[model samples]
Target chain A: MNSEETITKASVEDIDRIIHEPARLNIMLYLYVVENADFVYLLHKTGLSKGNLSVHLQKLEANGYLEIMKEFLNRKPHTMVRLTQRGRDAFTAYRESLLNILQ
Target chain B: MKDPLLEQVQNDVATEQQYRDGIPRIAAGFFLIITMLLQMNGNGNTFVMFVPLMPTIIESLRKRFTYPRIGYAKVRDRGSMRKYSLWAVGILLLVGAAVFFINQVSPGTIPQENHQPLLLMWATAIIVVLLGIMVFTSRSNIMATLNAMGVVAIANRFFVLGLHRDALYVVMIAFGAFLLLSGLYSLLSFVKEYPVLTDE
Candidate 1:
């Protein structure tokens, strides 16, 4: 590849497009720290509507960034979510990209 | 992209770090009351024995009960708190044991009225410092203000107005009971707020 092509490719690769969305980023960051959290917990913390959160969570899960589990609490559905190892790595890469760009 | 939503998540994580637990507060309250009971009997050394155990007990209880429902996340103090906590405990113990030793040797090294105030001062200092660290680390304005009120209350009670030992016990008992009640309230609140979803 030409030098110009290599430079452009590297810059494009730097940004984690999958985690670039704001809502999904927030969810990923929250799960990154807390390790695991309930859907309601994330809903409250993120201040996202139930439908909106479920949508974003679905996207992250599709990308294998997180794992969502369904449990029955008091005979009601409880959704617990955690970032998979792949998700953690992506987050770390994203943070580094931000730092690199800022620097 | 520094947006309000990202900021909110950051703030929430900080809040989680210093988030107060009702049950732990009650455990501390109980520990304070028990310490006061020992003080009432003039049992100095024994108080120390039980004092350190309270936090461990409270943590265990929290893991079993509060964690399953609400979630569990610990603040990463980055080892600063460990050093500060150890130093603070050592200094307080040294001061306490010195006075006790002096009293044993001569029977009145520290006047009876003075010891409580002295302990209160150390406690207030530690509380202020720890809460100050929490304020800085957690970036919570509430903690910044809360410690100031605590310091002033201690000062007013013992420094400005003398409190007899009986009054001291009463004060500690009231504080302890407040903790216990707060814990109960938290427990109830948690149960209501986050009911058990499913065993799986």
Candidate 2:
């Protein structure tokens, strides 16, 4: 393949991996569409158990793809999450890169 | 499952949003009182006139409790609160301007005799305006709520003092206590809910 094709192929693989994990990808997608979501809300939407959701959320948060805030509601625990600027930008870029490869 | 605590939290969020939505009307009422006060011969008594409106404000806030807007996808998912806050701020400015015009028309009605109280009112109003600006520009809901409470407390205290009523001191102390407790609660909850993700 030509140098341009080779470079494009490499970028496509990167994008694919970024969005390949079902749990992490869904988390990103949900955050991308909504401005912010709490842990309960995310759990409800993703249909993931509390423990499972917590683990994946930490992974995304560790990558700087999400900002998490914990606050109490009626003395009980709660967690709120929102996508960071970098996360939003990266998600957009990843989608565009995948689209380019598909075309 | 069937969690009453969850229900209560939902109610609180709804109540807060409802109170926020009514800010425009509350601001208008305050402006009206300020106008009547400016027209009165004894501007010092202006604070006394504000007492009757206190019930109205409280009632409006209480109404918010029954109408919970929490957990719904539309209200919770979007940042629409910021937009509503901006609209309320605009309405407040419009009403404030109208009140200012009344003050200008009735010179000396403010009783230059004790400009200290009037100065305090002006300062409180300025602070409220600044807080409203912050609420409009930022996404911090908790900060906005605290700032709003400050606005109400300041207005009430100054107005009551102007009327020679010392009861506001008790009210202010209670409010301060409530804020301290709530702040500590929120901080602790934040720490517990999301342990720091260390893998960055």
Candidate 3:
């Protein structure tokens, strides 16, 4: 392949597909900076609908990128989500890859 | 642009961590006022005993007032607070031990005379530097205001020092008042901004 084609292919392959989506990326970035946060906090920060957030969170959990815990808070159901160790590593690597690609 | 999303996320996190609740500021303001009061009454050393408890007091206050309104999102550096608290306690213990040792080893080795002006100047410098760091990190309006107040307090300290050395208590009172008022304003704004969210 030519240099331009090679660079494009490398960049494409470097991106982590799971975190490439805008919503999921936003979730990851938020979780990356915090130890753990509840669903309401995430919703408030992301400005995403409840259903949309739940769906994305489930996707992340399925991919082993997030851990969602369900508990009772004040006699009400509460969901807390945090990035797993693997998830943090993935995010750091993803960030580095993106920076490399841009450069 | 160089990753606007990441930059924005970082800014949001810092804002959420520092400005989401004014509990720390309120607690700190109270601590300062109490310290000033004690100093004015010739019981300054007595209040140093409370310095080690300040972090725990602040945390408990935050738990009671802040968490209910804004859901908990433990920031990455939140653990560092405990470490700092421990350090504060350690430093206090060391200072106490040193003072006691000095008194025993050589009576009157330590100066009993109040160096209030010099002490206030040093305090002003330290507080300004800390407030400057807060402003640099968060760039929030509240922090900027606090930093400005710190600068003004430092200037006031110098003015008071030059005019009347004995009136150094005024500088402490003024600075404490600024912190108390600013904290009250922030706490009120935070309550209004984020009402207690009912779990759906």
Candidate 3: the clashing residue pairs are: none
Which candidate has the top score in DockQ?
3
| DockQ sort, best first | 3, 1, 2
lDDT of each: 0.62, 0.52, 0.66
Docking quality class, candidate 2: incorrect
The sequence of per-residue lDDT tens digits that candidate 3 reaches over residues B42-129 is: 7766665765676677667665666666666766543333444444334435644675687679876534453453443344334433
Which stretches of model 3 miss by more than 4 angstroms? A1-3, A6-15, A72-78, A96-103, B1-8, B77-112, B115-166, B198-200
What is candidate 3's lDDT per residue for A1-103, written digit by digit as tens?
A: 8998798788879799999999999899889877798887777677787789889999999999999999996688888899999999999889988877777
**Which candidate number would show the highest lDDT if scored against the true structure?**
3
Tens digit of per-residue lDDT, candidate 2, span A1-103: 9998997878766774645588877777666655576665565446676788888988887888889888775566667789898888887777778667777
Q: What's the TM-score of each model vs. the native?
A: 0.58, 0.39, 0.67
Candidate 1: how many backbone clashes? 5
What are the runs in model 2 whose C-alpha is more than 4 Å off?
A: A1-20, A30-103, B1-80, B113-162, B165-170
Clashing pairs in 1: A72-B197, A72-B198, A73-B196, A73-B197, A73-B198
Report the Cα lDDT for residue B62, model 3: 62
